[model samples]
Target: MRTYSLDDVYATCKRRDSWWTVYFVDPVACRAALLVGNRTNITPNAITVFSLVLGMASAGCLAAGQLAAGAVLFYLSFMVDCVDGKIARLKGTGTPFGLWLDFMGDRIRELCCATGLAYGQYAATGNVDFIVLGVAVVVLDLFRYVNAPQMKRVRDAIREANAARTPPPPGPHEPLPHQSFSHSPVPHQLGALTVRSHPVAAQPSRPPRSRKSRRRLLRRFNKALARRRVRTHLISGIEFHAAVFVIAPLLGQAALIPVTSVISVLFVANEIFLIYRMWLFTRSYSAVPKPEKSREHAPIGGSPNV
Candidate 1:
């Protein structure tokens, strides 16, 4: 088998990941990935299966009311989960099936863990509220996953529609076309609201430029994050999972309810923030320029041959 350095392993890591994994897990996982990649022929799918087993074991421990053991297993499961992808990227042996399996495995792990924690607590205290919390957590997780992709699709569709309607820039020698902005309204459904889109009125054509100061600020921010290997989304799905499975559990069983409630509220707030951003984005559609009629496409001669 071929060997790779630590730099190679780091290069294969995700550019942006959760702070927990970027700081705590990757330091260990990258070394493990290198060792596995260089010393063994173990495939990424195999590691995914192993991680899934660990996750299942963690769920079993939680269900049995073994909080400390469950916490340890859960963290180990997540760390190993992080490793498989790095190994896949390093080895270049990833497959579509592996991707599908990994996704399905994560979903299964989350579902099992949530149910186990709820059932164990309910069993211990005879309180039904834990069950309710479990169901709500699962629902919120699903909402986050489903909502993100659907919203992204809507944004992509909007951009594509705008691109199709907007005409290309004219050549230097080409004369300017006779132009008039259309006031025709195109109905677009944004979430629950259905509104009409009206392109902006004609204006002086000038080269578009973004503020250099703003660009500089953004560049600096990205560089700072890149140094640590994370992204702007500090409370993404990974963090949510860590809060519920690892952090909350480790904080002791007495703290579970409050911690879970707070994390759930944060998740809902994050989703609402995303929707607000999308609403703001819809405003840009009104700025897409309407296509103008160009004489360049007409026949060269005065009239067509009859």
Candidate 2:
């Protein structure tokens, strides 16, 4: 029999993840999934599809005014969503199609849940305003969805450029020691034991910025906002939907749904602004020649040995 440590569970997660994902959600769900996965042949794509079904069922429950059941299903879907990615990373089975499918599922779930909650509220209170709010939520969410890829492209381009400029580390190094696995004969305690592992976050290597370059106030501001740990937790779609559709409804405060739409708009606007800044940054660097190493005191138009 195989035994897994908490470190094994954490190794599957992103170093820099959303605060709620890191702190509240993924750790528990992924750990549970890891244990189940050790004993089962369940695939990550299957879990993704299962999560989507749960999300749809949650939306149906919300539309039928089963608030408690809807909230429970919605949260369960989110937990499963967390599990799928971890499972994929652990099993080395993550694919581009799987990622695309997961994203598409999230968008569908968001739209359905928003509409369901709005319709449910309208049915309960006869308020037409809820319909407008629901439409706003969907539109803003779509805007975000469209812009996300563009933002990712810009970020990827920047990373590529930085990687091209950075010199590779000297190699011909000693081989890394082989890792060994162990199995325990006795069962160990399960659940509620938190173990933390520190993984270094990857940052692009770039030349030091000059004072003039640093004075690009807007870029500096956007960079600061981008680096904030709490930003994703507060404004990301998953967290927003969880708060609005699941937590708020569970607490019997469906009025908070409109506020979530407003927050979505704000988040979308912020993303658009950041994308614009990244485009400008990318454009500025495109004109610059790539840096090359030069020999000290090398004569012009002659070999270094001259």
Highest TM-score model number: 1
The candidate 2 region of ten consecutive residues with least summed lDDT is 175-184
Candidate 1 lDDT at 239 equals: 79
lDDT of 1 by residue, 111-130 (tens): 99999998988999888888
Off by over 4 Å in 2: 154-234, 286-306
132 in model 2: Cα distance from truth in Å? 1.3
Runs off by more than 4 Å, candidate 1 = 171-173, 176-223, 287-306
Best by lDDT: 1
Expressed as tens digits, the lDDT of each residue in 1-306 for candidate 2 is 455566776777776565566667776786777776687777888889999999999999888888889889988888898888887877777899999889888888888988897888789888887788778778767876777787888778777887687766555663322221223234243574333333488997775677558768757665665564334324666556666777677877455555565666666766666777778877776543655547767888888665
Cα lDDT of candidate 1 equals: 0.84
Clashes of 2: 0
In model 2, residue pairs whose N, Cα or C atoms come closer than 3 Å (at least 3 residues apart or on different chains), thus clashing, are none
Q: How many clashes does each candidate structure show, in the order listed?
A: 0, 0
